[model samples]
Target: MTNENNPIDFGAFTEPKKRPEPVSAPEESKKEKGRGERQEWVSRQPAAEPVAPQKATEGQISIKGPDHIIERFKQLCKDDRRVYYDMLEILMDKFEGK
Candidate 1:
């Protein structure tokens, strides 16, 4: 369970370095926030308001195909940096000679 006689020699290790003391906020910043308390960075930045999700206008369609073919189609779309449905629409339009 235990390896008292290891083949490799790890060698002597040096002592861990001590962490630096935490820096207090500037006098002006402490005065703005309140004395002795650290000013959090998040408080300095504007608060993010919740955004409403936009609804998609286009209707959705389901697809059925061989796993390998589907994977290759998805990979092709990814390589072209195009959305799967957008790529299909473009291909269909091209085939229509439009």
Candidate 2:
């Protein structure tokens, strides 16, 4: 840009170099347009079976106890192929006679 205010030309405050336009691939090479648009052809592979959603637990808790007891609890959970929280939930239900 031509400088009008200052007699000195520092090449600052000038418009940046323009970037070249990106080249787009052929339409046939592009994937299905978008999620919203419906396709004319059916997919060859079978769709995956939908799984049931698990229950959401919003409550958060923190408990401090003896280290030995905690280690024993973790061992028991590993033996039964259960998570610490899942076993805790089961224990809670058993106590409530659910």
Candidate 3:
């Protein structure tokens, strides 16, 4: 009998589990694919290139609250656009300057 609090010895199981062989890489394409051709096949391109970095405005304040706070804020706006705008208005006024 083993102690309930003692860790189990997995050493008794020495047999290694056999794994399936991995698939080999696909053979290289004989034909060359141009960038334009790839783009045409893609239903949608990824998001637009990120905006160019701008120097932070002088005295600009940035604050980050917990995920719960953000989640709650989002929940407060549950399917309502006005609630989101109102919350932004209050937040901007309260913390944008501090």
Candidate 4:
């Protein structure tokens, strides 16, 4: 079996695959050393004080719609809460002539 009409010879494609070189022990040690140095630097830094949660600056808007519509909307946003909020922002922007 052969592809006679093809300009390129397919027989040249069967070259032996080259195996990847193994990582030397020193390289592995250096990686570990680098990680340890990073951890040490991070640990040396001053700990941040716990921040209290800030209340929403803009008052919340409650939309009263049919239960099925609200349920469908919630289902659409099942993957992410940001999707729903971002969509609301987009709609509001369109209405406000932004």
Candidate 5:
């Protein structure tokens, strides 16, 4: 109801300005929170599928017949028998050193 020209001063009733409180060190707040965050992230991950006891392909070789067997045997012999001998020699040398 006061006149616009009078413009009442309510500053006297207002609260005084407050200085801000200092922030605590980041580590004090973050350590506990970080563990919880990690636990949550781990829980959200998908669970791995359980392997079947009797696997469909267990003991089943795709290639069959005597020709395939002969070919496989020849391949195994040709692959790296020399490498196996070299590895054995290295192991023996190490054992002798020990």
Candidate 6:
């Protein structure tokens, strides 16, 4: 028989408390908030045209290869086109026995 005077504690099996939602500020337009006066409104200019690559000299010749080879060459160059061109020149010089 349970004692009628003693109360049973059910704290361990209680549900987790829910956190209160954060209150958000009201969104206001820049014009209405007088922010437009404080900030400068600069109009965006048109993008400049891309310059064409310079023509290769009389001694230089352009070679077209497979896309994969070109991509690998670009990767090997590591952001410097001179490295790739220099390597090609050295290879050509060695092959020509110069």
Position 94, candidate 3: lDDT: 84
TM-score, cand. 6 vs. native: 0.28
In model 5, state the lDDT of residue 42. 48
Instruction: Locate the minimum summed-lDDT window of 10 residues in model 2.
Output: 30-39
Score candidate 4 by lDDT. 0.72
Better of 2 and 4 by TM-score: 2
Residue 83 CA displacement from its true place in model 3, Å: 5.5
Give the alpha carbon lDDT tens digit for every residue of 1-98 in model 2. Answer: 34687667666557888999999876554545656454457788659877879988678788799999989999989999998889999999999999
| Between candidates 2 and 5, the TM-score winner | 2
* lDDT (10s digit) by residue, model 3, range 1-98: 24678677766668888999997643343223553332245557557777888885644345589999888888867746556667677778889784
**TM-score: the better of candidates 2 and 3:** 2
Misplaced by over 4 Å in model 1 are: 1-56
Decoy 2 TM-score against native: 0.41
CA displacement after TM-score superposition, residue 37 of candidate 4 (Å): 44
Write one digit per residue (lDDT tens) for candidate 5, span 18-98.
989997766646567675432244476558876768855524235457998666655655675544345446658999995
Candidate 1 achieves a global lDDT of 0.81
TM-score of predicted structure 3: 0.23
Cα deviation in Å at residue 77, candidate 2? Answer: 0.6
Each model's TM-score?
0.41, 0.41, 0.23, 0.30, 0.20, 0.28
lDDT of each: 0.81, 0.81, 0.65, 0.72, 0.61, 0.70
Clashing pairs in 3: none
Which scores greater on lDDT, model 2 or model 3?
2
- Candidate 1's residue-wise lDDT over 12-86, tens digit each? 556789999999856776666745566555666547876879988888887899999989989989999999898
Best-to-worst order by lDDT is 1, 2, 4, 6, 3, 5
Candidate 1 local lDDT, residue 39: 56
Task: Count residue pairs with overlapping backbones in model 3.
Answer: 0
